[model samples]
Target: MGNILNSVILESILLDEGETLYKQNEASAYDLADDNGYAYHKVAAWVKGKDGTKYIKTASIASRAQLGKVNVSVTGKGAAGLYEIDSEFYTVGENVPDPESIRNNSYCYSEVNNVLVSNAIYRSGFANLDFRLSTGLPLKQYFNNDGELNEATIQKVKNSLKPLAKTAVSENPPIMREHLIYAESLSAFVDWMVDENGEMVNKVSNGVLVVDVGGGTTDISFINSANEIYMPGSDTVKTGVLDVFKKLKQYLSSAYEIDEEHIRVDMLDKALRTNKFTVRGESKDCEGLCNKAKQHVAKRLNNFIDELVTTTLDHIIFVGGGAEALREQLL
Candidate 1:
């Protein structure tokens, strides 16, 4: 009984007014989140045909399939007398968990996308089960502009998850006993600092800044010398490497007269890597343009980071999907 989550860290962090966020709760008494519920994967639609044909995909399978949503109906927000999600259809393709939208405080585990994700995971197991679910918010939103804990948002997360049932190509899967939420960058920091035993490792006793670069937003979390978060230093920036993908698509459109929708994210990534853009089934070198697009977005991210971080910090860690791509350009 040394740490609340001796198992999950590898963690959970909660902070209040002017206090350090590195919390330690009752040891061995923590609710561990199921990895399937919290993993970031390219999920495909769970499709069901009239002849009882069914398809459930997640991770590489979903990414390979290139579909991320399924039409669903959630019934009655089922707690405190309500049943579950509303009985209306949640539009199919509109639920992609875009990083920029999440930073803007518009996404969460309670969303229909998560429900679909949960359902797919549950159905694949084909067994009755109960598990904890965890999610994160952008660093800046986790702590409001005043550096105070955003209780309202936290409560909103808890409230909106009101026991709901979702049907997406299948009946609602009975699972998810608990829901845990934390800040995006802060979660990164905790994972970096602790081990499976919840013991500190790779110690950074002084200020350490954690940067989480995702698809469309970058979240920054900094813990100062006093062991407390420096709120003024934390932020959720709109700049990210995916911006380069969009810019490149636009570049290809102007150069090749191709529709933007016709080019997918995977194609743009390959093009930037190989310096080739395929148009009309022909590959063309576009290295110079690719570098320009990458640099433009990377520079915007660097500018914000330069202003936020100081030389006095003990460490600066860069993580997330965008980190390695922008590493060559970052300070």
Candidate 2:
């Protein structure tokens, strides 16, 4: 139990709604810049008779750093239909474009757990160590129609993560000893208050609202005095950081005549925060489009908060990857 608690409390992996993976206090996950599905097919067609090694070295299609080790696979479609499948050695990116997509897929689950394992090993100072994972679900999924935690949903999530328990990779592999999950409201509250010494960082016993603005959804929770979490009034917003990326992707695609697949969510996300981004080997200014998207998201989220929260709240704290990005707008 102590080991499990240490793993759960010492580190955390946040699988944000945008399909972005994050490891706490260590390396933040990055996406594969290449579209891999379509872009690879287009690039593979032109490199048919050319030297494969030379093409990978000189091609401006994808940077070596972005794609990592490239793998080319060929498949027969039908009579006289030969198709090439170009992909990275490992998985990256959202694999699908839908903003409402669920994280039930293997790609999403593996990446998230892999980060957890990596962090656990680092914290333990051992190359191979067991870990207990702690994650959270949105408020809507926390309970069933009976107002009880839906065991079925929790078990389904555990089953989905079973494959990542003992992941075997080229580098130091981690063995997941156990896994646990709690309501995200609790997770948010714990993440904010707990410090490195496992002591409460803030003495705010007053009602505080925690707004976790993530990629696809914004989860709001209120922690009141006496360290109690009141979740009946908690809510989730459908629009988040990814919505901004989609809008920016559409704007850039139409403005520059670039393919929609060429724009990645991470790139546009960086641009929104940094005000500069790269597309098709060229750096571009995206401040205007990014600002427009940010302003719109802020307005929509503000409307939700105005309706839900009350004047009794002492502090409204923002957390999560997109929290900082949307902070200025919210304020």
Q: What TM-score goes with each of the models?
A: 0.66, 0.60
- Candidate 2 regions exceeding 4 Å error are 1-90, 93-127, 145-147, 165-174, 191-206, 279-282
Which TM-score value belongs to model 2?
0.60
Worst 10 residues of 2 by lDDT: 38-47
Candidate 2 collision pairs: none
Per lDDT, the best of the predicted structures is 1
User: lDDT per residue, candidate 1, 97-189, as tens digits?
Assistant: 221122234554445434434433332331133444555666765677888878888777666656444433334434556667777677667
The Cα error of candidate 2 at residue 180, in Å, is 2.0
* Most TM-score-accurate candidate: 1
